[model samples]
Target: MNQPSPKRRGRFITLEGGEGAGKSTQVEGLKRFLEDQGIALVTTREPGGTPVAEAIRGLLLSRDHPAMHPDTELLLMFAARAEHLRTLILPALEAGRWVLCDRFTDATYAYQGGGRGVDPARIAALEVWVQGPVRPDLTLLLDMDVKTGLARARGRSEADRFEQEAVEFFERVREAYLERARSEPARYRIIDASRSVEAVAGDLQQAVSSLMGTGQGT
Candidate 1:
């Protein structure tokens, strides 16, 4: 009989946060850092990563859909996520390439469950149905006060559908993120994102280095 092939698993790192938490900047820096370490990787974003998913993302973010139901929004997000995982994330991981995603299902829980008052159990059911055994190995929650983050986000560009939400909505989202991190302390690193850019970058580098040293990204 032929011998079984060795299993190769790649790390999945997700960055989660409310708007203006500087996730985009840190993602670029982390990508460069991983490349320097000779790690094969793919960088992508949630609600996207594939053409179909990107289309869904456009729909999700468009400000014209003010009447879109909360459940509709949640379902659309999972629809996009399912495509992204099946088409991109799972394949890359099976090929032994670290996958760095801008956001993931956690965002759904935060934005939909917390911000929109959807039931956590509903989100959990969808998560299990959609992702199965796939989950992020590390999640960096870039945390900051909602007001400050929203201000920064607005300064950068016009608000999107989610961004245009009231401050209280984002507060709930932030709390949900923090609650998750608190519950899964080992899998999450809550980075204080209110600091300067350089400071945030340093913390991210340290977190990446620690994960690298443990062969987590291999």
Candidate 2:
């Protein structure tokens, strides 16, 4: 009788931060570092990834709509997340590829729950529903002062819906992320992002190494 090899579940890692906090940049750098070490990986993002979710992402990010209600935005984000998880995230985790996600349910908590003044309980419930058992094993939060991050974000052309938010809005969102990180220390690593990109990347590598039990091999 031939027995199958045990399934190798992948570690789910997510990068979270306010707009312009350099999440995309760092994710790319970290991915390169991890690959250099010979670790197989899959990189993806929420409110996207799946075809349906990417369509939802368009609605969520569309700057053409000025009157989009907060509740509507929240629901849309969750809807996109649900599709992304079922079609993309879950499969990647089950296939033994380390999944590096750009953002996830935490963004809903920070952006809509904290930034748009939505009810936290609802946000929590939606997260539980959408993400279920496949939550990130580690979430790297790129922490930077709102003013600085926003300035960096603003320098980039075409502010997204979140970037269009007021500084006070993002301040609350930042607080929300910090609050979550504080409450869930085992799952969240806060990286000070005000430093130079190389320094932040160095710090990020260290954090990821600690979480994953070795430098991705490099």
| TM-score of each model, paired residue for residue | 0.94, 0.91
Predicted model with the maximum TM-score: 1
Local accuracy of candidate 1 as per-residue lDDT tens digits, 1-218? 22212233788889999999999878888898898899888999988999999999999999989779999998999999988988788788878898899999999989999999999999998887887756788898999999999999999999898888899999999999999999999889999999998899888878866667465332
lDDT string for model 2 (77-96, tens) is: 98888777767776776776
Best by lDDT: 1
Clashing pairs in 2: none
- How far off is residue 61 in model 1, in Å? 0.5
